[model samples]
Target: MTRRPAPRPHPANRPPARAIASAIALSLALGAPCAQAGESPATYLARIAAIDDAGPELDAVIVTAPSAQSAPHHPGAPLDGLSVLIKDNIETADMPTTAGSLALAGNATGRDAPLVANLRRAGAVILGKTNLSEWANFRGERSSSGWSGVGGQTKNPYATDRSPCGSSSGSGAAVAAGLAWAAIGTETDGSITCPASVNGIVGFKPTVGLVSRHFIVPISASQDTAGPMATSVTDAARLLTAMAGPDPADPATAEAGAHAIDFTRGLATASLKGLRIGVLRRQSGTMPGVTALLDRALADMARAGAVIVDVDYTRDPAMGRDEGIVLHYEFREGINAYLASLPGHPAVRSLEDLIAFNKAHAKDEMRFYGQEDFLEAQGSTYTAAYRAARANSYRLAGPEGIDALLARDHLDVLVAPTAGPAWTIDPVNGDNFPGIGAGSLAAIAGYPHLTVPMGAIEGLPIGLSFMAGKWQDERVLKIGAAYERARTATLAVPRFKPWSPAPD
Candidate 1:
């Protein structure tokens, strides 16, 4: 199970600096504004070139989009001159929408997901697609987070050999590495927040349906939503403002149009003053270094006039079981529906077809882990068991969980450690998640969840998550913006280190 990576500059020797500085410095050196349709700024191209020169081309980016660059850019647009990459699962008219699976190798339908269209209207350049966890990490039980059959494994910008966490691993890593100004990532659970946390970037998973999921590869319709992974909270708001709207094709988003607002407006005066926050002490886990950082962040918030109250929310065995059932039933239905809707794929129209595809191509697709999850989803049915599990799970996670806690404690949102620092990327044994994550709480409830760079553990970044009940998207983001401002000085920038603990 041993492997080797090409050598690169070690982070320990390099000074900790903002990853975006390389791009800005290069742009200034070469003169600014490399403007043209389907072209990136002069600095970004140079920055990408630098990475290419250092080692590999198969990092985060999979397919590059030149045709979409010709899309009309309205003057005085919200995101003019900005370049953004979307997860490969989200359909783009000009790019193949592969969820890092060989089954959808050449999916091109000449249509953009509504959220992607919203981005184009906002004048953002469609950079391309980023690699993700194969089938968004829903294919196998012990699957590696960043490795994919199509795009291979994405590395953490801070540590090349460390896990980036998925299935939005590429989007998070690309933004942190300055491959793009920002990127779009879809989350069914921690797909956005986990990768964003470990990559040392800001990741926001808005309430389900706030950003349209139309034309994106499906997981669970109740939980899937597209959001932004960016360098800062303000940048996230800018992207969210453009991405949120009602899409006629997706019924889930019928009420989303009404909630759409200038998300940036909430950031200008962002503050922690008079805010009541609940610290999920039970959920934050017990990593000594991580707890110290969380303590510091909470102290900073308190010093800024915020009230911190400790809350104990114990886990229930039933929630995980129900979620499994819910996802099992949903994955079968969702994947079948998505595949059937594709322009042409006669052989890959259902989950059963996908299982067959992997078996036929086992040498490539199942080189690391077998698709136990695909098999489970294939066997699952939308029976009374599924409905009961879905309802019970929702109740446990939403009204009886986060909502109940918030109401009982008179708090605005709950805070916890996003996850432990990135584990070493090991395909042989799969991911060794060091600690627990509260992403499932918000994810199951279809509420808003955001992770901000709190601090680092031996140069590995950790995130502080802020979660609130459903429809509180702006509120959740506003609170995160305030925290980001308070803790900006301590945030860790990626140093691009190689694997540590020695590969044995």
Candidate 2:
């Protein structure tokens, strides 16, 4: 994998010390707005360009330029010229789809992943690829999110010093910072929802088979699916409607097509009325503020005429354990195939090459964390132990966890605090968390999970999740929209500030 140079700021927006000095000097010479009162076009252009020259501190994660081919046709077009920052793992014929590793950095397949093709077909602009955790954060035990060999480290737009959450870190950060109107994010476990929750955006992890994963870098074919992260539920739904469908490349699409419904239509404010919503009480016990937010949300839902059922998720941790095993085995096999599919391929077709690559480039790749997860994955084959673990995960997350509650309580959706808050981004120590991922049950069970911005702690956003049974993408979207409509949080755009002056 080769690391590409970061996209340069357009000359008009370049903010170097020299440029800032020039602007300051010009502003003084021209007397600012007084001169602008009847300024000529050239003067106006110069002034505007000066302000535009402010650089983003974390431009490594945000794509400044978009693809001309994927640009929308009109202002109110279906996607309305909305820019989409695709996760590096999701292929876009127009941009490099490196799965956050140097191994696949030079392997840009000149074909859009089906989801991306559909996004363009719906008039969405293909913005640059967002950086992610190397190999979707499947690299090591203490790996930091949003850091990739090819893309460097993606800083959180909110705090600048906090974690953005992996492996969809860039996607979440870009959308939350208004770098793009919406973005395509892929999730295997907490990839999509976790980042979205921390970034304070709407992250929709559709039912396992709901969205096609034809050209995306695979983790586990069983659980990987491309979804949307947006500033609002409506925008996310709009993007999802365009991306969900069957693809000849992925047989999983066969199950997705029948379940693919127009996710944006008929978003009713009363969608939650008469619905049975279960609260995952066990998940947010550590975060009191998060629990309070959920309590207020639950009361709001009840006021809107919904039934709430309190649940204890501790009844089964075995399910998560099993799913972890399946992911490990599947990561090895699936990533191996993805590596082999590259044009001319890599000298290392298996995980062994990756290990060697990291070893050789420890200064660049292993600066943050070791690849213990990859080592574990390499050691684990699709043995009987793997099968038993995978089976138990599905059985427990399904029949015992989700289905049991749904059947007994007659539930329509399950609600919980998606995650606590954005932890400080520590390159030395890695992420800090309470070990509560409520969306995992939905993810491992192939169900739909939607996270909407609830509020923030210290200006960093948090999200409330609403998960529904399999093939219930529409229901989840509808309920999420209702909650979003009841309350809204607008995210701020990132002000560009170069990491430092250009090295001579």
Candidate 3:
């Protein structure tokens, strides 16, 4: 889930901290069973330091806010008294937004991203930043998912030795472990969904234009969006209602004011009865256990009255290559502009400077892998090929991909396994995880995608994905809620196992 290049073409990774303001929404919407057994938000936050640092040693949280310790537990707004963790890439006036890198360790911007402000306006506490993949995993081909230069490695709460996935690794793990009511994670592609699926939580990647990208670290301007990660669909919807609104600075969000309404209002009302569901048979991966779980999920949806029909979706072999091209071109443009937009803080100012900073701090940043994607991004420029790739990729992924399938099948949403189970953490050779990804098409198309816990394999949680065309965020959530109701299994609780055996 990362990309950077100097030697080997880096894999790709997150934007910074998102905000969460859905505690009341969670309680009112779903009876708050996902809430940590009557624990107050303040109490949950107060213990985060102890839980994240010792014992299971999740390392999920990068820092904790002292103010949160004394935060009021009063009855107020919808998100009032809600505790949330921000990804380190997001700037907070009080804490350094390091993006899990040592280079921007001085990036105390003295301001909150608009998403954070929205959460605050809704009365949610800014609990502090969570560690992420270094530069959101845009450094090396073989880099570890949760290992960062500044925050070390983040472990899965389900299994200490398993992966939490990147670049929103900490946010997913923290939320799943009940370290916070919910956490915010950014996704250019798999940053949010992958980690959410990996850690057994619900992650929503709203339409890119639905949330403001201002004041956060850049990945791809076209694909990056900050969203909510929680234990339930209702909880995620609550945070998203707070996160969504028009931002004058973010041109992509010009339409957000119209489409972004209270997402939680109709979630429970969205019944599977008479709903036309399209099954992307080929896109669903072949991991036997994961496939079995997905099949069971589909059957569950069918029993609830969904009209499931198979859609033979075709893939353009070039989609992956083209997405890589677009990311490379955009990351170069976005990162340089983001660095220059910063206040007087000094360290790495551009991609070139960041590479140098990493090289200088090789003992930490380069200990596991190299910054080949940074080098690759540095070498890319505005070109006809880049433009062509962007146009084709967008068309194929959006119009000809998800949309074409829906229109042809007269379907409301598409379904698939969010991803395979979490692979063992291997910093030496990078992630060994596999998937048929319901994330990429929606991610590249800038559409709404949601993941909910389907079932667990060997005590490790995996998710079932629901996706739809642009601005169909509400529909996906409703369907997910319907599926959740249909599911016989309760939300699997993390037992903090040392490790889970491979599902045979």
Residue pairs of candidate 2 with colliding backbone atoms = 1-102, 1-103, 55-496, 55-497, 56-496, 56-497, 57-497, 93-112, 162-425
Off by over 4 Å in 2: 1-13, 16-56, 59-66, 69-77, 268-270, 345-347, 488-504
- Give one digit per residue, the lDDT tens place, for model 2 in 386-495: 88987788877777778887788789888888988777767788878757557888888888899987776546567889987788888889998887765533332222
**Worst 10-residue lDDT window, candidate 2:** 31-40
Per-candidate Cα lDDT values, in order, are 0.82, 0.72, 0.81
Model 1, position 307: C-alpha lDDT score: 99
Rank candidates, TM-score, best first. 3, 1, 2
List candidate 1 stretches off by more than 4 Å: 1-42, 52-58, 68-72, 499-504
lDDT of 1: 0.82
Model 3 spans with C-alpha error above 4 angstroms: 1-33, 36-38, 72-75, 501-504
Steric overlap count per candidate: 0, 9, 20
Per-residue lDDT, model 2, residue 466, is 91
